[model samples]
Target chain A: MKQPHIQLKLFAALTPLSPENSDRVPIEPGISIKELLDHLDIPIVKAHLIFINGVKRSLETRLNGGERVGIFPPVAGG
Target chain B: MKNTLSHRLNTLALKASLTDGTPCRTISAAEVIHLADDTGITGRMVEIAALREQILPDRYLRNMKTLSEADQIRLLESAVCIVGLGGLGGLVTETLARMGIGRFYLVDGDMFEAHNLNRQLLSSIDRIGMPKVEAAVMRVKTINPGLEVNATGAFLTSENADTLVGSCNIVVDCLDNIQSRFILEAAAKRAGIPMVSAAVAGISGHVTTIFPEDKGLENIYGPEDQLNMAKGAETRLGCLAPGVNLVASLECMEVVNLLLNPQKALRNRLLVIDLEDHTFETLQLA
Candidate 1:
């Protein structure tokens, strides 16, 4: 079977992790949010908020194919 | 007794009329102070000032259309604590003061630096050495003299957070560090006050409202230990003025909505904005 794919969105400082600061990327399926972060080389400590299909999820949460994922860095500045 | 209040209001109203005679009648800040001093009842003076446009010049004259007279009175009676006086806190305090919020507790331990001129509304080259809280106080006085402000030039710790925010109806999280934000959230929770929090980095930022019953900042930033281990984007990407102002404006709007119409305030969700692509997303918190 062909590998399933998911859409990923990186925000703010996390964009630099990707080429040309592309906001979206396609990822393989059956990956936990933590694994995806690692695959993208985004440190787990740098990923402050993670959401799948508009619902916040923990790092251990598994993502199915075709789901939309959004990741934000901790932006604590006043 | 009602007649006495009306009579005093009318007297002050007459004293406040603009001499320019362009028909945009407005009172000077000096007149309001004089009236409040003479009446020995600042609350009554504030009420009269809010009611009569000519008595205490308000930029929010149109806001009264959406906010009923009673709501305006409520704003005049409300007090909010701003825990920082940097980019976000400076703008938030200015907006609230213009919206006629009656009292403010401005807290910050930092002083204005030359670099702060990039985004801090209250910071300037002339005031580089001045304490941020003092600058905020001066700015609020210039914006609306009727506002009662308590400026604290000390950093907020667990020990002093409660005392600084205990009397406020709401707390705005403007601190730049996760540890300090946790301190503020705990303090607000202990005081049973709702907190409107926001943060900015690059061209993006996020805002959320946390009531006492909610999970609070911990849900977004994770456990205290985890937060201590992590780094904030501001430390890496730095901050942009437009992003800070945008997020702070949204935070102020949430605060006003919370105070006047709690049902409409942003709660239980985080609203994130990316000016780079102009995409705004509201994500539900687990």
Candidate 2:
């Protein structure tokens, strides 16, 4: 049987760190967003904006298998 | 009498090219000025009177089919406040002025420095020490002398936000830091106006429009803690021209939409653009 997974999208500086730079990522069930970031080697500081399945969510929000996630670094300038 | 003004406008109207070789009945900018002086009405009223008669101001003839004459007149009566006169605010002010926005409240405390020349639209070598708002007024007046401008060199803070945003149809947030963005969003909310915001760092940028009733920058930049981040990615990654102009253009487009076709404004969402990867995405926001 295949392991359950979530689609992951990383942006800007975070893009290079996506697993194999691929959008598809297999995940263990019931992982918190912060835990997932840790699993992916993203520091908590760089993960400024987090959206889970099109909704703004907190780093503490847990993700079950089969969610789509996006992470953006704080890109602030004029 | 309004009829007399209309009659005078009719006398001023002449057959002019509608920019594609099509003949159009239009009043030249010069003619509008002369008529405003002759009739003792503001140039804005003269333009409105001309538009009501289906006579195009030659300066706006090119906007014909895309925007109706009434739309042009609406543009002529609008007020916009641009909070930062750096890369994004400079382009937005210049572009909107050319588009015929009638009034402006330009606020920026900084002066042009050598570093601004790379991307700031209003900065030049000779004007290095001039206040950004002063330079902005000079450029705006030269573009459309009919415009009314209230320029301030004080920075945007809660004390000044209400004054800057009052009576304005909408606000554009070209501010560079997270702290100021929060302050601007709050002021726009209190004034019950919409704000179109954009920011750039490295080759990437983000654009979003916030309606007064909706949640603002906190969702995108995170809660109060992120504000303490001091400088953001821009400090380390730096901003370049392509990222600045592209994001600023998106903000300006949102400005136009909110003013005229407001139903189509980019509300409740964020547009992320990565020039290096050439990818653009719109994600729903709270």
Assess each model's interface with DockQ, reporting 2 decimals per model: 0.71, 0.64
Tell me each candidate's RMSD, in Å, in order: 3.9, 2.3
Tens-digit lDDT track of model 2 for B94-160: 9998888888999999999999999999999998999999999999988867777899998998898
Which DockQ value does candidate 1 get? 0.71
Candidate 1, after superposition: displacement of residue B46 in Å? Answer: 3.2
Off by over 4 Å in 1: A1-4, A19-27, B1-3, B11-31, B48-59
Per-residue lDDT over B1-286 for candidate 1, one digit per residue giving the tens place of the 0 to 100 score: 6446455555545332223332333344566566677767674345555465433343444564576556777787889999999999999999998888988999999999988899999998899999999999999888777678988999999899999999899999988887888889989999999999988887798999999989978778887865564347777777889999999999999989999889887788999998987979999985
The lDDT of each candidate is 0.81, 0.86
**Interface Cα RMSD for candidate 2?**
1.5
Backbone collisions counted per model: 0, 0
Which pairs of residues collide in candidate 1? Answer: none
**Tens-digit lDDT track for model 1 on A1-78?**
756677677888887675343334555666798988787788887788899899998889987677888889888887
Q: Give the lDDT of residue B33 in candidate 2.
A: 84
